[model samples]
Target: MEEEKISELKDKLEREKALLEEELSTVGERDIQNPDDWVAAPAEMDTSESDPSEQADAYEAYGENVGILHNLEIRYKNVRSALTRMEEGTYGVCSVCGELIEKERLEANPAADTCVAHKDEEV
Candidate 1:
């Protein structure tokens, strides 16, 4: 990749990582032992006037936040791995077939490490 495009993508990735961290903080907290790991905020579980329906709502919210946190964590891992690959001078190369990935694919997803052909397959 050209240095200029790499620079632009680096900036975008950094900004995105920052935004992800900020969003994670709102509904989650990083694990003390593993900074890369995040956990959803504990469920509120208010008394809710001893109403079962109200308790169910709180549980639902908790489940939603947990799902969100899981997705963010996965994205965070992918982005981090991409950054590491860039440092290793292997960014934009298909991990499966060892071919240069399409520029359009990289533009769409900087974390992509494989070509369109290998995308749905395991590395």
Candidate 2:
């Protein structure tokens, strides 16, 4: 990739990373042991109501947040990995076929790690 293109992608990736972090912070906290991990904030349960149904609702809400957090964590890690690859000079290569990834694909998603042909394969 040209240095200029790389710089532009770098800026875009950095901006995306910042936005992801901000969104994550609103719904979860970063894991202490693993920097790439994030956990949803525990929902506050108001026990003063003495209603078992309300407690169950809180748990369900918390469960949904956990699911959302897990998805965001995966996306965040992929973005971070892509940024690291950019620094390592392997940013635009397909992980499966070792071919040059399409510029359009990279423009669509800077965190993309594979070409369209190998997009379904494991990273």
Candidate 3:
């Protein structure tokens, strides 16, 4: 990719990375032991005086947060990985085929590490 286009994409990726981190913080917190990992936000409920039904609802919400966090964490990691690749001088290369990734694909997903041909395949 041209340096100018790469710069544009880099800007886009940085914006996305910040947005992902913001969203991740809303539904989860970074694990102190593993900075790269995120855990679901704990429900702030005082069970001592709360009704049984309220406690159950809190648990349900926690479960939903866990699911949402899992998805957000995946995207966050992908964005971070893309940024790392840019620094390593391999930003636009397909991980599986070692070919240049399509521009349109990169435009659609700045964090993409594989070409359309390898979209369904794992790297």
Candidate 4:
């Protein structure tokens, strides 16, 4: 990829990284031991004062937040990885095959690690 195009994609990836981190913060916190890992924030509820039904509801909400956090964390990791690839001069290269990834695919997903031909392959 041209330096200018790579720079633009890097900017986009950085913006997405920040947005994902901000959104993750609302429902989770970065792990102390593992900066890349995120743990969902527990729902606020005074278990001692709340009824069993209320406690169950709180747990359910916590579970939902965990699910959301999991997805956001995955995206965050992908964005970070893409940024790293850019720094390493490997951006726009397909991870599954040693070939240049399609520009349109990259435009659609700047964090993509595979070309359209190998997109369905496991990274």
Number of the top candidate by TM-score?
4
Residue range with the least summed lDDT across 10 consecutive positions in model 1:
42-51
**Residue range 11-39, candidate 2, lDDT tens digits:** 99899989999888877898899877788
Which pairs clash in the backbone of model 3? none
Of the two candidates 3 and 4, the one with more favorable lDDT, higher being better, is: 4
lDDT of 4 by residue, 1-123 (tens): 888999999999999999999999999998999988899999999967869889999999999999999899889999999999999999899998879999999999999999999999935
TM-score of each: 0.89, 0.92, 0.95, 0.96
After aligning candidate 2 to the native by TM-score, how far in Å is the CA of 118 from where it should be?
A: 1.1
* Lowest lDDT block of 10, candidate 3: 43-52
Residue range 1-123, candidate 3, lDDT tens digits: 998988899999999988988999998999999988999999778868669988998899999999999999889889899999999999999999999999999999999999999998843
lDDT of 4: 0.93
Which of the predicted structures, 2 or 3, would earn the higher TM-score when compared with the native?
3
* Candidate 1 lDDT tens digits, 3-122: 888877777777888889988887799999999889999778877478898888988888999999988888887888888888988888899999989989888988888899999973
Looking at candidate 4, what is the lDDT of residue 113? 94
Which segments of model 2 are wrong by more than 4 Å? none
lDDT of each: 0.85, 0.88, 0.91, 0.93
Q: Which candidate leads the pack in lDDT?
A: 4
TM-score of 4: 0.96
